[model samples]
Structure formats: C-alpha cells, structure tokens
Target: MHWTIPLTEPSLGAEEVDAVVRVLQRGWLTTGPVTEEFETAFARKMRVKHAIAVSNCTAALHLAHLLCGVSAGDEVICPDLSFVASAAAGRYNGATIRLAGVVSQDDLTISPKAIESLLTHRTKAIVVMHYAGFPCRMEEILAIARRNGLRVIEDCAHAPFAWTRIGHQAEFAGAIGDVGCFSFFGNKNMTTGEGGMLTTNDDDMARRARLLRSHGMTVPSFDRHKGHASGYDVVEVGYNYRLDEIRSAIGLCQLAKIDQLNEGRRQVSAWYREALQGLEEIQVPFLDRPLEQSSCHLMPVLVHGSYPEIKQQLANSGVQVSQHYQPISSFTAFGSGAAHSPFGPWCLLSLPLSPQMSREQVRYVTDCLREVLAQKQLV
Candidate 1:
C-alpha cells in the first residue's frame, strides 16, 4: 500500500461505535456504569482483582503516588528511557524523582540492580515500565523492592498482558507490583482515545486511588449522579481524572477485543523479525524472553549508522516511520545541558503494526526500510 501507515493506530471496530451509541443515548455521560464495566473487564483481562479507569496514564501514575503516600523529598526510582509521565507522577504527589539508568539496549527496561543501587531511607517506590510491551525483570525488581520496604508501581503503558512466571506458575506484571498503571492512549497496545486504568490488590490502596481519581469526593459518584441523596463533598483535594462514560463505553468495547488486537501486533512483530533477519546493520526489536509475552506496541529498530538519513529516505519512499521517543532530559523542562546516550532515543525507529495492516503491507514497509538503510550505508 502506498498510503501512509501510522506507527500505532487504534483497532476500533463496529462494536465500539455501537457501544458508544448506547452510552450516548443514555444521557448520563459522566463516569457511570460504562466506566465501571471497563474497569471490571480490564481487571479480568489482566487477571487482576482490581482496576480503576481514569482520564489517562498520567492520572493513574499520580494516583499511585498518592496512594503510596509519597510526599515532598521522598524519592521514587524510575527509568529515564520512558515517557516523562513515569517520573512526573512522583513529582505530582510532591515526591523527589530519582532517575535510574536502563538495563540494556535490547529492551531498555529498568534493571532491578540499578534500582537497588539507588535505594535510600527516603526511597518510597520503584516505578518500573514494561518498555515496548517487554516485561522487565519483575522477580528481581520485586525482590529488591520487598527487601527495601519500597513500594512497586508498575508502568504498563507499553505492555498490556506482559507478565512473569515462577516455575510452572504465571504472574502478570502489574499484579505483582504494589500498584500498577496502564495507558489507553491512541498509541498504546489498546486505546480509548485518551484513558488510563489502575490496578491493585490492596483494598485500602484501591479506595485511595478511587478518591484521588475523582475530586476526592467523599460520596460515591453514582449516588451524586442519581441526585436522590444529599449533596456531595470533597473530603480531599484531587485532580479531575475521571474517565467519562463516552470514553468508558469505547474502552469497554476495546477491552473485549484486547487479545485479538494483541495477537495481531505479535504476529506483525514476528514477521518483521523474520523479514529483517539477515540485514547486517538493521536490528529489529525483541522483548526479553522467559518473562513477557509482549503486546508488541511498536517495532522500534536500530539502523547501525545512518539513522536520521534512513528516516528521511523512508519518508521519501512513501513510508511513515518515526522515532520511538526523544530523551526526556533533552527536553527544556529537564534542562538542556544534561548528557544523554548518543543512541538512547534518537537512534530507534518504529514501524506500523495494527490489526488493520496486512502481512504484505508489513513486508512492503520493511522492504522500503531495507532499501533506505542500504542506500544510507546503514545496512
């Protein structure tokens, strides 16, 4: 196909539209039954006991920090390779942010040992990300967190069902952590336009997350919506992080097809790996095995040398390729002079992998990539 293919696109179907229509017809468009249904289905799909839907991944992270009771000067260790929202969550709750180096170039997930080395009396939590659907070393990281009495907050933005195993047992990534956060943004494994979900087994933590997602409203939102009861009150100040019914309706529908969409992404990733197998300078991405069955959110790759030129060439060839991310430290908010790895963020590229894409299409894109890499002397 000659048309533009986005790096990540929603796997929306007719079911999503029908569900949203039902919700819109109901007239109560705020957080309601649809949101609750999305939460329940998301929790069940993740095989966890609780899931709280919110406005976005940022809200989920902020609520996790609040539930952990992280405050000013308290440190939370997070990977520098991920989106800024991961660390900003700590700052949102008035906590000190501590950055940790990535484990390897392969997956770029945070190393448990790196996190352990940074622990101190002020350390409050470990915000580990499942980079690009590749599950981190959860067992090692959780062991360190448990040993240090530090809370583990999972960032599932890139990983959906990515989890762990223990000698004939199964362990979902977010379930093992103290609190887990997930994004349903358009570019994620699955999307709700803009939404997030939080999961935890602890009842107290679940309650606190609920309060924080709302405006710290003391009354159940359902009751306030009914207006049959007395007026509501805000017991604690909170952000407006609730996921409205319209978005929740979309999310609930999306959750039902999560496995199908995930499988498509996985197949696309496998095809990319196989097609680019022998290219000397082109390295397609892979998740660290023995742990995660990644949802394959993106197919970011390294083209040995001519990375920038390859992107330009691919664009000229009518292919849409993009860098996975820019180093957060390179941004103005984090300051300009801080040193970043030469290949850390700028060196990677993402290929399209949606259910809407076909095997032939994936091959076409890869062929274009191979051509560009070769022309640029990268492969």
Candidate 2:
C-alpha cells in the first residue's frame, strides 16, 4: 500500500551510491580509515573536539552512559516524550530511568523544571532530546546540571545541524552537553542506513569512548592492518559497536549536504503551516520557531478531535503519516501505564515530511486533513 506522499524518505543519489562502491572496491568493510575520515568530518562540522562513529544512536547513548559512570541503583532523567532508546540506553548500564515531562503541548522538549523535580540522591545524569529538531532550553537545563553535579547527555537524533543560543554564542545541539548522541538512521536528516555519532569536548571522555567503541582495545584492526601495531591489548570491557566503512562513506556524502537538505524540509514545514492555518481543530506546534535554527526533522500537529478517525481518513485519501512517538513512559517495559501529557499518542499526528516534499504535496495533505475534520464535524 503506497501513499501519494510518504511520511519520510532519504534523499539518496549517485554520490551515496558511488561512495558505497568505492568502499567495496577498497576491500575494507569494518571500521577503518574511511570511518575515521567520516568521524573527523562530522566532528569538524559539529564543532566538537571528538566524534566517535558507532552502530546506532542507541550504541552512542550506551557508550555515553558507560563513560559517565551510570550504573546499578543510579537514575538518569530522560524525556518521556522521546523515543524509547532515550531511556533504554540508561537501563542497559543498569541505571534506573526517571521520566521527565515535556515543556508543554507547543514545545515537546523535556522540561527543565520537571528534570529538577525528578532529581534525587541516586540521580546521575540528565538526557535531553531535542524534539522534532527544535533545540531544547539548554541554558536552564545546563544550570540545573551544574548545581546538581549531574552529566547532561544530549539526544540529537532529530537535530543534526540544529543549534541554539547559549550565552551570546550559538551552539550546535550535540556539542552543548557533556556527551552528545546523534542518529543517521534511514529517515533521519542524514542517512547512513544504520549509524550514529558520539561527540564530546572532554578529552578524557573522548579517548575513553573511542577505546570502548571497539571492544576496549589498545589498537583497532585497522591500525594492525596498516602495520601500525604488531599486537593489541584489551584494556576495558566493551561491545562491538563499530560503524562499517560502507556506511561511513555514505555518511560522509550525507553530511556534506545535510544543511541544504534540511532547508528543503524547512520549506515543506513552512508550506504546511501556511496550508494548515485557520483550521480550528488542528494546532501546529512550534509556530513561532524560526526555520534557520532547526533541522525540521518532523512536522507534528495536535488534533483536538478524534485523531484516529482523522488519521484513517487521511490514509484513505492516499496520504502517509506517522507518530513521532508514544511517550516512552507509556510502554509496559517502563511501566508508567499512562501518557505524561494530554497530547499523547492518539492526539499527535506527524504529517508527510521530507526534503523532497513539494508545496503541492503539502497542500494536498492539508486539504485532505481539512476534509477529514469536516466529515467528522470536528471543526
């Protein structure tokens, strides 16, 4: 079942294909020089001292938790509105997860006040996810961390090139905290098929994360292959979370033009806002947000009436849509049993969004949405 306009799609092309082919021709598939090159390029663009490429964002978060010394009986405060991996990463390190509510219905980022309220003797760190590419209020959140001596791990899956003002200067999403984790999944602003990046300004943490990324070895196989070392040593216990050369090469290509691609997403978002205006039953979040500051990773709207019926009707009209998430706390694994906000899974709908989306497509989606609401007498 194909929709006239899909929710999201990667803007892959000849460059990505050529990069993969070059990697295959080089005969080095695992983490190698190409991976290092990708890491360097990413770190430079992100304005971070170090960037360690990993298998996925979950792996990056897990590494961040381990490096921050999150362990059994400790608690990590995370956004209840984000993807489950935001909380699951801490659980992997044996840390208890403390759910933090969002700022409000209009701004879905983790609330700084909620984070402060959740702090306890066992609290070790705060994980803030920039919801839908909109940067979280980092200044207040960082102040909270400083006063509590807690680590701040930024989940930047939705915010690759996104930035915000901290003091008088602008800072990138992943570079503002103690450790920043990023995603390069297929649907993300950038794509590497399945990969992520861990960034930090702390030199010691960067060194440790690099060592821990590939089984805590004194020297990786790439160095050995190049005759840099005859033997290697395992210094610390680590997991096999290395990004392959093929994906790394692809990431290089994606990173080069991510800003342009993000601009296209912003345009689509603008069209959506224009087309969605005057609909009483529909409320678009981040209406005041400027496009330059965000990557515009998602286009979610809060429906005042029957969301399920609206969604089904839109689908029937050949429009594909999605939900950014159901609050992580609502999952049975987390055992919260309910959503944290009134704008929960059933009320929030992510409309079709992509760099390739055209104004006509956006108008069509909104037209269908208007029809659906009118049919249900929601507006």
Candidate number of the best lDDT: 2
Global lDDT of each model? 0.79, 0.91
| Regions of candidate 1 where Cα sits further than 4 Å from its true position | 1-3, 166-168, 287-292, 335-339, 342-346
Question: How many clashes does the backbone of model 2 have?
Answer: 0
* Model 2 Cα lDDT, one tens digit per residue, 1-379: 9878888989999999999999899898999999999999999999999999999999999999998999999999999888999999999989999988888888889999999899999999999999999999999999999999999999999999899999999999999999999999998999998999999999999999988988899899989999989998999998899999999999999999898999999999999988988878888888888878999999999986555677788889999877778888788899667654456443888998999988888989998888887777743
Worst 10 residues of 2 by lDDT: 337-346
Per-residue lDDT value at 94 in model 2: 91
Please give each candidate's TM-score: 0.93, 0.97
> Cα lDDT of model 2 overall?
0.91
Identify the runs in model 2 with alpha carbons over 4 angstroms from their true place. Answer: 338-341, 344-346
Q: After the best TM-score superposition of candidate 1, give how far the Cα of residue 370 lies from its true spot, in angstroms.
A: 1.5
